[model samples]
Target chain A: MDRVPILKAGDVLLVSIQTDLEDRTVMALREDLAERIVRTGARGVVIDITAVEIVDSFIGQMLAGIAAMSQLLDARTVVVGMRPAVAITLVELGLSLGGVQTALDLETGLRLLGAGPLDGGPSEAQDRR
Target chain B: MTTQPGEQTHIVELLRSRRETALDRWTELAGAELRGRLSRGELRGELDDLLSLMLRALDGPDAEAAHDELTAALSEMSRRRARQAFTPTETAFGVFALKQVVYELVTESGSNRPRLTEELMAFSHTVDELGLLTFETYAATREQVISDQAEQLLELSTPVVKLWEGIVAVPLVGTLDSARTQVVMETLLQTLVDTGSLYAVIDITGVAAVDTEVAQHLMKTIKAARLMGAECVISGIRPQIAQTMVALGIEFGDIVSKASLADALEYLLARSGVRIVREEAG
Candidate 1:
C-alpha cells in the first residue's frame, strides 16, 4: 500500500515512489495529472521508481499512458529508474512502449526537455522517496 | 469532399514560407490516409512497390531518381499539410496515410516474383509483409535498427494496460537519435500524466551508443517526470555509455545505475522489505 509521492522541483516535476506497483498506486498517480503537467509551464517531468521489485503489465501500460497524456498537456515526460527484472520481463512480454521517453536518471531526463538536445548538456540525480 | 483549392493554394504559399500549422495539417491528413490504407489494404500495391524501392535503395547504390521522387512527394505533402488544420487523431491518421502508401508499395514489390507466373497469387500471399522497414520514410524505423533492440524492448517494456495510463518501463536497447528521441519523449510524458505513476523506470543496458542527444533526452524525461511528481529511475549503465558520457564531458549526479535487472530488483525488494526464497543449489 505504499503510495507514490508527486513533487514540483525547480523547472521540473518529480514523482517518486517505492516498489510494490499495484492498482491503487496507479489510481493515485492518474488523478488530475493534466493540470499538474501544464502548471509547470517549464519543460519536463520525471517519474522515479528507483525502488520497485515488481512492475507488472498494468503499471507498464499506465506509465505509458501518462507519458502520452503529458505530451498533450504541454510538457515532456521521462520514465527513469528501472531495475533489471522489470526491463527483462517487459521485453519478453513483447510490450511496445510506442510513445514514451525513457532515461537512466532524473537529471539526464530533464536535460531532454531542452529543444531536442540540440544545445548539449547543462548538468544533472538519483534520490529515493 | 473537403479539398479546397483556394485554401490549399494559400497553404501552399504558407508552407513555402515555412508555416508550422500548414505543414502539420498536410502531414497529418496525408499521413492518416496512408495509415488507413496500409491497415485496410487499399494501397496494397503501392505499399509493396515502396518497400521494394526501399530495399533496392539500401542494397544497391543510391536511387537518385527515387530519392528525388520521394523528396518531391514529401515536399508536396508538406505544402498540403500547410493548408489544413487537423486534430491529433487526424494528424495521426495523416501520418498513417503516408505510412501505408510507402509500406504497401515496398512490401508488395519485395515479395512479388516476376518469374513465377504460375504462382503469382501464391507469391503475393507470401511476400507482402516480409521485407525490411527503412528509416528514410518512417523516422521510427531508425530507432529500431539494433538487431535485437525491438525484440529486447518488447520484453522489458511494460505493457499499455491502460492505454494512456500506468507505470511503463522502457529498456532503451540501441542508439537514441533526434527523431526517435522525439517520439519517446512525447509518448512517455503523455503516458505519465494519463496514468500518473510516481515511478517510471528506464533501463538502458543494451544501448550500443549514447550521444549528447541521448543524455539530454534522459534529462528532459527527468524534468518532466518531476513536474508530475513522478520519480524516474535509470538502472542500466553499460560500460560504453559511461565511457561516452565521460568522453562527452557530461555530468550525471546521483543517477541510479545498476549492472543488471537483478541488481535493480534487489534494490526495489530491499525498499519494500519483501524477501523471496532464492533457489539454493544442492
Candidate 2:
C-alpha cells in the first residue's frame, strides 16, 4: 500500500527513495516513475538513494532498468547519493551499472542535468523552465 | 621466620649481604658476554639495579608475593635491552651470569655445607626461570618491532594526493596484495568524498607486475570510486605491464587507461574543462 513520492521541479522529476525497497515496491516505483514522466513530460530524472543501503543484484538491475526506461522516454536519469559500502558490495557482486550516469549528490545531479544540452544557458533556461 | 621461609628467602638474604660482591662478579661475567657492546661501568649500573630487585624479592616475608613485581621488572629490563638492540643470547647471558655469582657464593662458603646441595639446586632453578622470562620478553619485543615496521611499510606503499580540484591521484608502488588493496580502496574512497572530487587517477607506474587478480582488485577500487560518483582514470601503463595485461587476456572494458601520469592528467584536465597553454619566451 506504500509507494515512493515523485515531485516535479521545472522539467525534472525528483524521486527520493528514503526507505528500503521491497521487490514489489521496486516494481511499483518503476511503473509510477514511467507514468509520471509521461504525464509531466519531464526531461530529467534524479533518483536520490542516499538512505538506501544493501543494494543487491535485484535492486541493481531495477536501477539499470529504470535508467534505460527513462532514456527511452527522453529523460536522463542520474542516480545519486550511493553510499561507499553499497558501491563496494555492488562491485564485488559484479553488477556495475554501466549505462547509468551517477552524481555525488542531489545538487550535483541537478546541476549536471541543467548544464547539459537539455537546458539553455543559465538565465534563459531558468525562465523557460 | 626462623624456620627459613623456602628457597627464595634464603637466596634473598645471601644476595642482600653479598650485594657488592654479586654485582661486581656478575658485572665481570656479563661484560665478557657483552663483547664490548656495552661499557662495563654502564653494565654495572644495570646489573646492580637488577641484583637489588632480586634480593628484595628473596628477602620478602612472603617471597611469592613479590613474584609479580619481579617478573614485571625482568620484563622491563629485557624490553629495554631489546630496544637497545641487544641480541637474545646477550640478554639471556646478563641474567645467566648472576647464576655464576650465586653459585660461587654458595660453594665458596663452608658454613652451609650440610644444606649446600639443596640450596644450590633451588638457586639454579630460580636463575633458570629468570633466564626464561628474559628470552620470552626479548622475543615479544622483537615481534612488536617487526609488526611496527610492517605497518609503516603499508602506509608508505600507498599515498593519495589531491592533483586538482575535484581530482585526486594515488601513485601506487610495490606489489598489490589483498591487505594493501583494502588500504588503497578505503583511502581512495575517503579522499574522494572529502574533496568531493569528480575524478580520480590511479597511476600504477610503480607497480611491478600486472596479473588477473591485480586487475580485478584495481577494477573493484575503480568501481567503488564510481559508486561515490567519481570517475577513475588509470595511468602509468609501462610496456611490460601492457604486454602482461594483453597476454593474460585482461580486459579493462570501458575504464580509461593512459600510457603515463602526464597523459592521464592531460585527459582529466581536458574533461574537466581546464585549459593549459604555454607562452613563448624572448
Candidate 3:
C-alpha cells in the first residue's frame, strides 16, 4: 500500500505527489491528510504536482475535494508546481479547480503559506520557527 | 505481309520527309485551338520543340523504343504548359494536332490503301499515348502548385509576434480547420518555450466566421498555452461572432477574451505591470 507522505514543518504540511496518482491513492491521500491535519494541528498545506502530466476530471475533482476538506479541518490549501501541460489538461477537461489556490513552485507555495520566499537555501527551511 | 516491325519503319520514313510541312499544318491547327491565348512566337517555338521531340522519339529502332523519349518530352511539355497557364485540352491538342497532320499526309500519299490504314492506326496510337502522358503530367504539376500555395498560406496566416518581454501575440486570419489548428498549436507552444513568455494573445480579427468546431479548437489552443504556464487571451470578438456564439449556445468559461488586439495587449501589459508612458516632445 503506497501512500503519499505528509511532512510537517511547524504549522504547514508539505505534500509532493511525484507519482501518477491512482484513484485509490488519491482517496487514501485525502483520508490520511485529513487525519494528519487534525492530529498534528497543521494550519497550512502545500501540494506540489509538477511531475503530473495528464490530469483528467477525476483527479481534478479529487484535488478540489482535498482542498475543500482541508479547509473544513481549518488548514489552508495551496496547490503548487502544476505543470503547464497538466494545467492545460485540467482546463480542457472543464475542471478549473475553482476553490484551490495555486503557485508556480514549492518555494512560492510556502511563501503564499505566509513564510516568505525561502531565503537561506533548502537546508535552513522552516528551521527559524 | 509487312510485320509490325516493317510497318513502324515505313511510317517513320514518311513522317521524316514531310516533318516541316507537318509541323506548319499542326501549328496552325494548334494555334486555332488555342485561339491565340499565347503569343504567336512562343506558340511557334513550343510547336517546333514538340515536332523535333516527336521525330527524335520516333527515330529509334522500333516504335516501342520511342515510348521512353516520348514520355520524357511530353512530361517536360506538359509541366511547362501547366506553368504557362495552358488548359489541359489545349496542351493535349499539341500532340493531337500532329496526329491529324500525319493522317493527312498518309491520305495524300499514293500508297496502297491497306498500308495507309496500318500507318494511320499506328500513328494515332502513338499520339494518343503522348496525349495521355501530357494530361497526367499537367494534372500532377497543377496539384503541386495548389498544395504549395496552401502551405504558403498556412504559414502566412499564423504569425506569432513577441508583444512584450513575457507576452506573445498570434494574429489569426481566415478560417480555422483542424490541420491549421494543429499548426497554430505547435507554433504557439514552440514560441512560448523559446521566448519563455508567460502570456499569449490570439487575435481573430481577420477570421470571417466562427462555428462550434472553431470555438472548440480555440479552447484547445488556449488550454494548451495555459498548460505551458502562459495566460492566453482571445481578442477580436466582432458583434456578429458574438451573436453567433450566443445563438449557438457556446460559452467560453473563465477564458479571457477581449474585443480587440489592442485591448488584449493592454490587459496583458496591465497584468505584467508594464506601464506605457508617452514621451513629451522636446
The number of the candidate with the highest lDDT is 2
- Residue clash pairs of candidate 2: none
Tell me model 3's lDDT, rounded to 2 decimals.
Answer: 0.79
Per-residue lDDT tens digits of candidate 1, residues B1-282? 111122222222322343333334434444444433233242333334443443333232455555445444433333333333323343234434433433343354454435334333322322222211111323332233454675565444433232112345666766776556555655565565455444566777767777787887676665555434455667688788788789899765655656776676565455434566889999
lDDT of 1 at B34: 44
Residue A29 displacement in candidate 1 (angstroms): 25
TM agreement with the true structure for every prediction: 0.31, 0.87, 0.73
Worst 10-residue lDDT window, candidate 1 chain B: B126-135
RMSD (Cα, Å) for all candidates, in order, is 24.8, 4.0, 5.9
Clashes of 3: 1
Ranking by lDDT: 2, 3, 1
- Residues B1-282 of candidate 2 have per-residue lDDT tens digits of 111245555566677788788889999888786655678898898777777666656665655656666788889989988988898998999899887888787766545656667766676777788899999999999999999999999999888898888788999999999899989998888777667788999999899998999999999999888877889999998998899899999999989999888898899888877889998998
DockQ of 3: 0.17
Best candidate (score: DockQ):
2
- Candidate 3 residues B1-282, lDDT tens each? 112445556667777888778777877888875555677677778777766656656655554555555567679878988988889898888778887787788777766755666667876787787788889999999999999999999999888999888789999999899899878887887777666666899998888899999999898887666544467899998999999999998889999999999999999888876778899999
Question: Model 3 — TM-score against the truth?
Answer: 0.73
Model 1: which docking level applies?
A: incorrect
Write down the TM-score for model 2.
0.87
Q: Cα deviation of B18 in candidate 3 (Å)?
A: 1.1
Instruction: Give candidate 3's root-mean-square deviation (CA, Å).
Output: 5.9
